[model samples]
Target: MPRGNPSPKLAITIDPDVHENILAAAAREGMSVSAWMTAAAREALQRRAGLAAVAQWEKQHGRFTTEEMNEARRSVQAQLRTSRTVRRPA
Candidate 1:
C-alpha cells in the first residue's frame, strides 16, 4: 500500500443473503470477513484510481494507440504467467 495511516473501526449490517456471500468469499481467500472486506475495498479504490488515470490520459492524448493495447496485453499475459507460477502455501 501507501504510507502508514491510523487504523479505524467500521461496523455495518447487510442483508443476510449478502452476508453469506461475503462469508463464502472470505473463506475462499482464507481471511476473516473484515480482512476480506478491507482487501476488496482497497482493490476497488485502486481500480478507481487506475480508471481516473486512464481518463486523464485519454483527455490529454486521445484514445490509446494499437501499440499501447498490445503492450497492455503483453503485460497482462506476463502477470498471469507469474501468478500461475506461484504456489499457495499449504
Candidate 2:
C-alpha cells in the first residue's frame, strides 16, 4: 500500500467479547474502531512477516555470532520497553 493512500474497506465479524474489546481499545486510542483495528491488524501482520523472515534467515545461516545475537536481543528489548511505555493504563 502507498503512503497516504486510503485503506480499502473490509467487513469482518467478531465474537461479542472481541467486538467490545476492539471498541474499547479504539476509544482509548482516540481512533475510530476501523482505524484502530486496521492499525493493529497491520502491525500484527508485519510482525508475523518479520518473524518468518528471521526464521528463514536463521535456517539458512545456521546461527548468528554472539555479538549479533546480543544486538538482536537489545533491539527487541528496546522495542518491548517502548511498547510498554506507550500502552494505555488498564
TM-score of each: 0.71, 0.69
Off by over 4 Å in 1: 1-6, 84-90
Residue 73 of model 1: what lDDT? 92
Best by lDDT: 1
lDDT per residue for candidate 2 within 1-89, as digits (tens), equals: 57797768887879999999999988888888877887898999999999899899989987778999899899989999998888654
lDDT per residue, candidate 1, 1-90, as tens digits?
757896788989899999999999889868888888898899899999999999999999999999999999999999989988996542
Q: Note the Cα lDDT for every prediction shown.
A: 0.89, 0.87
Question: Which candidate should be chosen as best, given TM-score against the real structure?
Answer: 1
Weakest ten-residue segment in model 1 by summed lDDT: 81-90
Residue 19, model 1: lDDT of 94
In model 2, the runs with Cα more than 4 Å from the true position are: 1-6, 63-74, 83-90
